[model samples]
Target: MKNNTPSTAHLKGTRTETAHDGNAKVWLNGKQLNLQASLKYCSKSPTGFNWGYGGSGPAQLAHEVCRQLYGLETANLVFQDFKWRFLVTIEGDTFDLTLELEEFNVGHVMPLIETAEDTDLCETQNGPTGHGETCYFDADQGL
Candidate 1:
């Protein structure tokens, strides 16, 4: 069986685990989740990843986590909130955030995804936004 969970539509049992040693590390299922994909869209932290704060590194992590479980589109939709909600709360160096995607009610963001299907969720002029940046998705108003 594969340890890492790749991005897909069926992400019911997927899990995202983040650990902080000297730096941040993200794991999907039992394997490490890569950050290159997320960075391709928007490079945040080229050195490494971090959490417990609303910053570039955390934003990169948020995007990667969602991207790993879902896909690029969905990751763009929810990564901002992901950084604010879960990542920022991770305090201390020895933290483990095992997010069971399904149990975490990731489906709640589906409405936003549906809206995304009709309208482009990433409506930023500069591209995907980082933490504390304007993560708005709309023609007029935004999220």
Candidate 2:
């Protein structure tokens, strides 16, 4: 049978487990950023998986993802289980990003599978948001 978790299968690399606390911090170039950021896995939702602060969409979400995933040469992030904090500078634009994990929602983390009917969610400059409706693994449960 196919697995039911998105965190355990999609991210194929070294990862560490963290405790859920609803708060954490991410940094870049020795600078601190957002503190109330949330991240949740949504491997089973229609809108596909999304990571953002509060209910903000695409642009903000893209920045949040890139912040944590981006770095000068490498990006080090501390997954405080229930929260994420990071600093993001899109190419040259700078911004502080925070993500909050809500109830470990699986549907919010899955990437949006491209459908013939639905066009990809486009950002002004960030290309595809990668919120595709299918995540081979769960972001909450490590592999």
Clashes of each: 0, 38
In candidate 1, stretches whose alpha carbon ends up further than 4 angstroms from where it belongs are: 1-23, 100-108, 121-143
The C-alpha TM-scores of every prediction are: 0.62, 0.21
Error of 1 at 16 (Å): 20
- Model 2, range 1-116, lDDT digits (tens) per residue? 11232231111111122212322233433344333341232211222112333222222333333334432111111122222332122221223423332233233322222121
What does the lDDT come to for candidate 1? 0.57
- Compare the candidates by lDDT and give the number of the best one: 1
Give candidate 1's root-mean-square deviation (CA, Å): 7.4
Q: Stretches of candidate 2 above 4 Å error?
A: 1-25, 28-62, 66-105, 114-118, 125-143
For residue 40, model 2's alpha carbon misses the true position, in angstroms, by 24
Model 1 lDDT at residue 92: 64
Q: Report the lDDT of model 2 for residue 128.
A: 38
**lDDT (tens digit, per residue) of candidate 1 on 1-143:** 11233323221112234333214556655567566655676566665567778977787777777766656666666777777867787766545445644433344465655465456454342444442232545666655
